[model samples]
Target chain A: MSLEVKTNVAPSKTKVMTMKRLKRREKIEGWLFVLPFVISAAVFFIGPLLVAFMLSFKEYSYLDMVSMFEAPWVGLSNYINAFQDSTFLRALLNTSLYSLGVVPIQLFIALVLALIVDLNIKGKTFFRVAYYIPTVTSTVAVSVMFLFIFKTDGILNKILSFFNLPPYNWFGDTRLALPTIMMMAIWSSVGLYMVIFLAGLQDIPMSLYEAARIDGASKIQEVLYITVPLLKPTIFFNLVVSLIGTFQVFDQAFVVSNGTGGPLDSTMTVVLYLYKTGFRDFQMGYASAIAFILFAIIFILTLIQRKFFGEETEF
Target chain B: MKKLIALFTAAVMAVGLFAGSTFKPAKVNAATKKVIRLGVWASSPAESELLDNQIKEFERLYPNIKIQKLVITGDYNQVMQVKIASRTEPDVFYLDVYQAPAYIAKKVIAPLDSYLDKNDVKDFEPSLLKGFTSGGKIYGLPKDYNTLVLFYNKDMFKEAGITKAPTTWKELEEAAKKLTKNGVKGLSLSIDAARFIPFMFQSGAKINDGDKPVFNTPQAAKGLDFYVSLLKKGYAATPKELGVGWNGDALAQKKVAMVIEGGWMIPFMKDAAPNVNYGIARLPKGDKEGDLVFTVAYAMSARTKNKVEAAEVIKFLTGRQALSMTAESGLAIPSRISMGGVYTAKYPERKPLVDMVKYSQVYQFGIKSSKILDALNKACEKLYYKKVKDAKTALDQAIKEVK
Candidate 1:
């Protein structure tokens, strides 16, 4: 009996030792797998972020960029100057207005598109691919095309003229410029969000819809009751991401406005303004301050959105 | 196990063989060849090809030196500034006169006083040379320049029964009125300060009175008012109003009969509207025979390690032969006064453009010019868009912001 017990104990002890060795091996392998990403993130992301943060507190200009460490520190003066600058404020206001105007309209359109594509229809796969084409296409190319299409004597104007309507100076008109850009932004990006919603729609259990149908619910009612509630998490995710993206709109504005953000600075987004100030004006310290402030604004806005519309999952 | 090991060893040997075959040994004469980098804003493909040919010629002349041309397309100044700040700027780069002052003040560009002799400098137009000189130190050598000239369609002139191009602002207005007809405006102008500054200079109104914007004076106002009156009278339209991109486009499309454009428009007119017969003339005389000249210079970066070699490259590129070659493109007039006659003789269409250099005023928008210009442009746009009623009010507001 003692021999039997000793045999069991010895085998168990060896098994535990092997298990420990396996765990250690897994940890080392995991670290090895992540090393490349970690190194890149440290070098490209974290290092620049740290430098930008340091630059925000200093009186750095283009002249001092070569020996940045030698630049004089000016506390919160750069931040103060950003607040006082009228152009910065205008940019902030324009970006916020742009986001407010674009996000809801884009989301509604995307949701509608997602619902339509999810129905029992022919060539759904073709439609799905067709919708995603714009997302994959280059933004610069799209912006340039939009510029041509929205110009005063462009196709849109030609169409309007057929209906005996007056042509509009879409980009050159200050009042219309931002809205025109916003329209283009929505048109290009709605497909991406629609795809996201489509994924969310697919994940909803058929059982829920089956039960809702038995209750004599209409098609709209079924969507209102079954699909949307389940889509809250996805909706929340897209909202946050879209909000962040719209806030940082640069390429379309830059390309359309020809880098001046003009027709009287009407289409000047915050990133474009930051670019002009940092590179054009060579005020790196002030630009860094603007970047940090923009970061804080986005972070706070995301938190507020989360508090209001975040998913509430019951276990 | 033995077979697997043999396969792995063979794979390793194959990889080694491929790598060894692909790898090239460094050139033996690399140490003797000095590599100089030249940064230039990207132009038309034809221009780039011409530049390449010029570089090849330069290389043939000095076989020991190799030139690497870096073409930056968008946001040229911003990219250049970043490169300068990082001390990684090209040995030689193009610098606009408007941007030269700030660079010179910051010592970002090296002065060429040590390299260029008075004889070499005398070949350039005195005014053109003066544009690159700050504190009596020559910061750059002018490569070429473009001056504003009146481009008028011959067909439109015949339709309007106008015999000759306008030589005065009053004559210009009359021609504009006569030229205004179905679906076409008389004149097209871009809503830009650079385009409007010629009027200010013609009216004997300085853009700045010793670093203060005194352009709200009555003389300046009169010049601006004349431009505004043309717009208000429906005789002149902006490129936007006419549904075109710029004055050149409007002129090409025959949407406008006349456009005051730079020498660069000659080639564009030829390519874009070859059927339309257009004539170039000196801009209609305002208060004086005032016209604006814009020039870019071949400037060396202060941080360049091979300054002497880079200076030599600049010299070769800006020499008479190189200037003549570039002038053949009809994109810009040669900065050298001696080459002007030759250039005009080759491209007779650009004769009026080249002739304007004698009385052309070099752009004097100082170091903080972009800001001042932005304010002025916004004001002008507001007036053009009818957001403001009078030039006086717009100019007043602009001057306030500029201050």
Candidate 2:
């Protein structure tokens, strides 16, 4: 009995010690693996975020960099001025309008695209790759391509003229400049959302649709009653992501307007305006304030969006 | 701005060349070796080539110093501001006269009083230095300058049944009307302040009255109206309308019969459209023949580690030998007032551009230059598109936005 007890105690103790050692090594390895990313994220992303936050409270410009830390602290005045600034307000309105115009249309088109592509159609792979091409292409290249396509004498105008419609200066008109870019934004991003919705469409069990079919449901009825209801989470996700994306629309507007937000600033989105304020005007403090204000708007809007779909997001 | 992009690309190529050379360790005395970085913009390969040659010559002159040439791409002022903010600005950089005032006010560039030779300073065009001077201190030394000139395709003029280039605004309009046929617009114009302000000066209108910005006054409208009327009447179209990159590109592409550009267009024409048969002339006379002078100066960094080396590089770069290369490049007129005659005599065809230097004013706005110019350009666009009813209202809107 003593021999048996000694054997059990000795092996068990050694096993426990080895297990402890393995766990510690694993933890260190995990940290080591992530260390490079962590450092970069801190330096590039988190560092700027923290600095921008601090700067929002100060009154600094490009020339005030050496005296950046010592620059005057104006508390909420920068934020106050942002609200009072007509250009800022106009930018805010333009961005809000752009988002409002973009999100729903994008989501609907993506859903439709996803639904169509999910079907057992001919050349399915070809269609899938074709639809996703724009998503994979660089945004600036796509923007430039679109600029050529939508210019006054571009292919689109030529196509219009073939049907006897008048050529429009898609980028030159203030009324149409924002919309032209909005259309480009929609065209470029709808593919990504379609991919998201494609995954959502494929996730639904065929049995649910089979049951709907058995109950005499039509194709639209099946999509409406069962597929869409079950896809609530994907819909919610796309909505939130698309909402955030639309709020930060800059590159398309920047490329289209050449960073001037021309045609009477109609193409001036909030982020573009913030860029012009900070980089162009060199009002870093004011730019920081504008950034934070945009952040607040995005945050509140996201919160509201979450509330609308929060319960459905749960498993 | 587009020229800056061209410069940036050329700079990238130049950087590649420098990088290739740097891979081989030079057998030099480390104790005596000093490196100074020179920054500039190049509109054409010729400009870059000339700079490279001058840099090599400079290195040979000062065996102890190595010069690193950098091109500040895109918005020159914006990039410089960022570089200045980061305290990593080049030892010497190109400072646009338009942006000189802001840099001067911010004390970003070192005053050249101590580095200057009084005789050398005297040789620089007084108008060129005016933008870089503040409180009796000169912050930059003008390296080169350009004045706007009319670039007309001789073939296009011939086809339009016109023998010579338009000298007066009315003649330009008539040429444009004749050129509007054959799907070619008479003129290529940019709805920009840099292009339009000369017209404003030609309007014989006062830009400001007692510190009150009054471009909205009826007299000032004369310039904007003439500018926009060309667009309205379908005689002149913007580069955007013609689907070209710029006034120079438009001329090269035959999208427009005539364009207003500076010496920068010369090398571009020789390279891009050598067979286009274009002639250069002073910008068509408005009421008073006012032209805007586009110039850049070599400015020393206020916080440079190699201030002595930097000053030496600037002095050499802006000196007579380097400027003679500039005059030869046909990229721009050298800043040395003495070189104007030499450059014109050397390239007899560019006499129109050189002659305008006497009548032209420096193209610069004090502070918030970009904002004011942006406003003015936007107003011009509005007028050109017929979004606004009248030039007066557009001018009013421009002044209001700037205010």
Candidate 3:
């Protein structure tokens, strides 16, 4: 009789009635909860984003901080020039390569680590903390450490030479420099994704795996069918986030190359090029243009990625 | 509504408290005592002490003026840029001559032609003073300068059976070759344009034509080829290859036998490699003669309110006595040409750097010279890493990119 009565009215209708009753007090509390983030985002992030958008069309240098209004507007010329700029194009290509190289490898390593840590194993907290340490450590410190170990005559080469292994010039080689940086990025960031995946893994109910086991599923079959599909949303989230992070890679490349983005500009990511243009060359307008273009690329790519993952969450 | 208002007020107070005083523009508050904020960067305590003593002497000369020294905490040029733009820059600040053209064009620094007298102008080295001058208006007065010279490890030279320091390009190459033995490098070379420009000048190559950097000519290419051959022939290696921070570091650690450095090397050598006996010589002559002079000046900011006091500080700081004191500390050679004799006599090792001042030129090109620098440096790395086999291809590619 209670079930039949409950079925007579929509759950959303009851929710709406309650929502209206509590609107005055609850609205204030809700606003108070989110107000800080809203204000900060408006001031710091959105404000600069709008300014950058406006500056993308103007011929402004950083010489005058208040020259936003005074700088000449050249329509979309700055954007046009960015496309024509071979160096910027090369930077774009390098950044694309970096994103491609870093995102998947980091994602895979992170998931494998997550799976390993999720087990009923000994020293579980120890493994989790060990993996997470790199994420918390400063990028500059890690780059400095890498520089010490990977330098031509460094300890790594000394060890390699002791065993008659050929010493690799890690950063000097144009082919290896960007990949080596990518390796550092992967090593540093894989842990954060692992933590995220670990959280997602715990959310998966034991009943699903038990049902699979009852159906005579093997361990690999249980994982391939149940675990991976359950973690798809988490994987998608990490992929998009890492894609953005990798595209904006600067500090590692900067510290490694001494801010020249060298080894023939092989490690010159878009952000590094944008930094050189805006700060070093004082071409703020052109750099803003490059920034907006990078923004468009990330935005469109994310939307496309959402199309593949966002539609299939009902499993 | 009253409760809501109270909550909002509390939140506002909390938010305001979270933000630090850094948000406040540095508007001076003292009513009677005029203050002049001086911005400086010092790596060592001794350097800071020397500067502090100079400031004390200046303040003693003028009792009314209170100088506040702001020790810069980051990249000096970038910091100064932001400060100047925000109108919060110090009254007097350090300005590198290499960066003078960009700053002068932006009108961030004051022109001190009227403040400086003829006697003072004549006293300064013409080349060094000229670096701070643009279109007959002086932007700053140089405190001191450094010209690059060859620094050789005496013990390594003896080991290699090279008694005297290399005097010519051929001899320099041969000495480097002879020193290339065991696990040590013959020389530590830098791929920076500042280091390479001297070689171009030595080869009778005009790095600049009118307002443009024309660094791809045959003579400059020859200089580039010769420079790269040192690395290619295994006679020289970059500091990174030797697992050192810089050429000086390599020399200090005895990983390299030779390096090209300047006056700062004196104090640095004393601190870093005090046990190692080293000698300085003028950069080995190429076809003709050339060197590089790095100079810095104490310039008044354009936005300085107390222009008179700032100019006075600049004058007192750059005066013969103050600069002579700076030179005495083995920090740098005073910009005054007249101080050259006494300075060299006191520290004979710095004589080569002091003597080469007449031959070297300040690094200057017209406004918006970024493309030239970027292109040339990329070319340098390409040659340096052996990505480009020959100098002509690399030089031409760099020239084409610039054009």
Each candidate's interface RMSD, rounded to one decimal? 8.7, 9.5, 5.6
Model 2: CA > 4 A from native: A1-30, A312-315, B1-30, B41-43, B71-78, B159-161, B206-214, B385-389
Q: What's the CA error at residue A70 for candidate 3, in Å?
A: 1.0
Residues B1-403 of candidate 1 have per-residue lDDT tens digits of 5345445556767999987865333234457888889999989888888889889999999998888898987779888877777788899999988887678877888999899877878999887888788888999999899899999999989977899999999999999999999988999978888888788778877777534677777777777878878888999998877877789999999999999999778778779989999999998988797878999999998888888899989999999888888877666678898889888888876788878887876776666676778788888888877888788788888888777
What do the candidate models score in CA lDDT, each in turn?
0.85, 0.83, 0.85
Q: What residue runs in model 3 are displaced by over 4 Å at the alpha carbon?
A: A1-33, A312-315, B1-30, B385-389
Q: State the DockQ, from 0 to 1, for candidate 1.
A: 0.40
For model 3, state the Cα shift of residue B12 in Å: 11
lDDT of 2 by residue, A1-315 (tens): 244455656777767766887899999998876665565567768998998899999988776536677888999999999988888898999999999999999899999999999999999889888988998898899999998898877999999999999998888778999988889989988999999999988888888888888999998899888888888889889998999999999999998888888778899889999988887677889999999998998899888987877565322
Model 3 interface root-mean-square deviation: 5.6
- Superposition error at A144 for model 3 (Å): 0.7
- The weakest ten consecutive residues by lDDT in model 3 chain A span A1-10
Model 3: per-residue lDDT, tens digit, B1-403? 5456556657877788765453343334335556798988756888788889898998888887888899888777767766765678899999888678778888888899888897768988888888888888999999888899999999999988898999888998999999999988889997777777788788888766645767778888888778878888999998777777788999999998999987778778889999989999999989988888988998888878999989989999889878878877876788888777768878886789888999988876556456676777788888887778777678889878877
Q: Extract clashing residue pairs from model 2.
A: none
Model 2's alpha-carbon lDDT is 0.83
